[model samples]
Target: MSDGIIGLIGIVALLTLLLLRLPVAFAMFIVGFLGLWIVDGWNVAAGLLSSETFTLASKPELVVIPLFILMGNVASASGMSRQLYDAAYSLIGHVRGGLASATIIGCGGFAALSGSSVASALTMGKVSLKEMERFKYDDRLSTGSVAAGGTLGILIPPSTGFVIYAILTEQSIGRLFMAGILPGILLLMVFVLTVLILCLIQPSFGPPGPKTSFSEKRRALVGALPILVLVLVTIGGIYRGFFSPEEAAGVGAGLAILYGLFTRSLSFSALKEAITDSVVTTATVMLILIAAHLLNPFFALTHITETVGNFLAYLDLSVLGTLLFILAVYLVLGCFLEGFAMLVLTLPIFFPVVLELGIDPIWFGVLVVLTLEMGLISPPVGINVFIVKSVAPRVPLGQIFRGVIPFWLAMVATLGVLIAFPQISLFLPNTMFN
Candidate 1:
């Protein structure tokens, strides 16, 4: 059989394995290893397995993953995330739907620290859900806002999603980080706007929270000051070329630990737990990357990327049409597959087509990450919705799904805006790097 046909069979088998509840890393590893063995030989496959594992494990760039994860874990353990939420609540909690808006702002800030949607959702859900319940906010709006806002984690700077995308496409992590900034802010605004409109239409959905005195606002802001400063230092240092992404991550992680210790908010046991969580999360990401590297070579041997490129060419679609087509596929795949798995599985096939079409990789990376965010709240496999459900066990799963729909539509609108004006995604990176 042709290599292309063999590759196609391998992909089908991989999907079957995933559908059967096999882990993403193992499924990719199995498919990639067997594809290599079939097309090349056992010796070549074994050689690659060892080399790829070592190469990814020892890479300096991957160090950012663990460091940023640790920063997030430490922040969560230390009540930094709670401080951020309180600061946001004090400033805006008095307005109609302000509480939900504050939750989104908190999620965005925590996303900067954590670069994890699950972490953002879980931490914020724990912090805000009960408070919202106390204030009699509708569970749908409360749960939905947390689920949707948490997705900001992947689009903001220090994002693990961007790091993986950068590695896969051989793009600059700093540039991708810069590219995400404006788009992340734009999405945050869109979500807040959605909440405002929802509350306007149905005032009972999110009641106006109590107004805080100026002193209270100041105190809450003071509590959150350390995290704000840390975010500025790490991200600003990268923008000014004073620190590489890796350096920034290490600094952020170190600062997070110091703040936790100084405030006595992070006990020894909590610190240890944070480290363990970071290690486990980092290991999962690394295994996926190594598996992707192995799978990439198999796809290359079969010339699947080239074949896919040709098929796109045969369609005679304009650049925008092709781009939209690819994004549409992502939206569909997102319903069934986890975001990272979908990313690794498809980028090798689709990214070359993007490069061939001369689309800017940084802009495309932002767009792809945004689409992944939508998937996190999309139905059936809405992972963030599930995360929110876990935190608010009393809320029905269906209610959480319903709550996310408006925000999900808001995401669709935000996606359109980003696509219409690619400059939003490119402006920061272009201005900084150029």
Candidate 2:
């Protein structure tokens, strides 16, 4: 059989494994290893396995993953996330649908610290859901806001999603980080607007919360100050070229630990748990990266990426049409596949087409990440919906799914805006780097 045919078979096998509910890392590893052995030889396959694994494991840039994860874990364990929520609530809780809006704003702040949708959703859900319930906010709106807002974790600065995309595409992590800023803010605003409109339409969906006095607002903001400063320092330091992304991560992690210790909010046991969680999460990400590296070489050997790129080129679509087509595929895959799995599986095939079409990689990275965010709240496999359900167990899964629909549509609108105005994604990076 032709190598291309072998590649196609390998892809089918990989998908079969995934559909069988095998772990993503293992499924990719199996497909990559076997495909390499079949198309080249066992020796080449074995050599790549060892080398790629070591190469990814020891890479300095990847240290950002563990460090940023640790920062997030420490922040969550130490009540920084709670402080952020409290601050947001104090500032906005008096408005109609204020509680849900506050939850989204808090989610955005926590996302900056955590760079994890699951963490953002879980932490904010724990902090805000009970409070919203106390205030009689509708479960659909409350749960929906958390699910939708948590997705911001992947699009904001220090995002693990961007890091993975950067590694896969060999783009500058800093540039990608910068590129995500404006688009992230835009999505956050869109989410808040969705909450406002929902509350306006139904009124009962979100009741106006009690207005806090200025003193109370100041106190809440003061409580959240350390995290706010940490975010600025790490992200700003990167923008200013004072440190690389890895250094910024280390600094953020160290500061988070120090703040927790200083405030006596992070006990020895909590700190230990944070470390353990960070290690486990970091290991999982590394394994996936290594597996992707292996899988990419297999595709290269089979010339699958080239063949796919050629096929797309022959379609004679406008650049915008081609871009939209690829994004549509992502939206479909997202319904069934986990976000990271979908990313690793498809980027090798689609990214070359993106590059060949002269689409800016950094801008494309932002667009791709935004689409992944939509997938997080999309039905069936909506990971963030599931995360929200775990936190708000009394709420029906169907309710949470219903809640996320409006926000999902809001995301769709935001995606359209970003596509129409690519400058929204590119402006920050261009201004900062150029």
Candidate 2 clashes between residue pairs 3 or more apart in a chain or in different chains:
none
Worst 10 residues of 1 by lDDT: 425-434
What C-alpha lDDT does candidate 2 achieve relative to the native structure?
A: 0.94
TM-score to true structure, per model: 0.99, 0.99
Please list the C-alpha lDDT of all candidates, in the order they appear. Answer: 0.94, 0.94
Which 10 successive residues of model 2 have the least lDDT summed?
Answer: 425-434
Total residue pair clashes for candidate 2: 0
lDDT string, candidate 2, 166-263, tens digits? 99989999999999888999999999999999998999999999999999999999998998899999998898888899999999999999999998
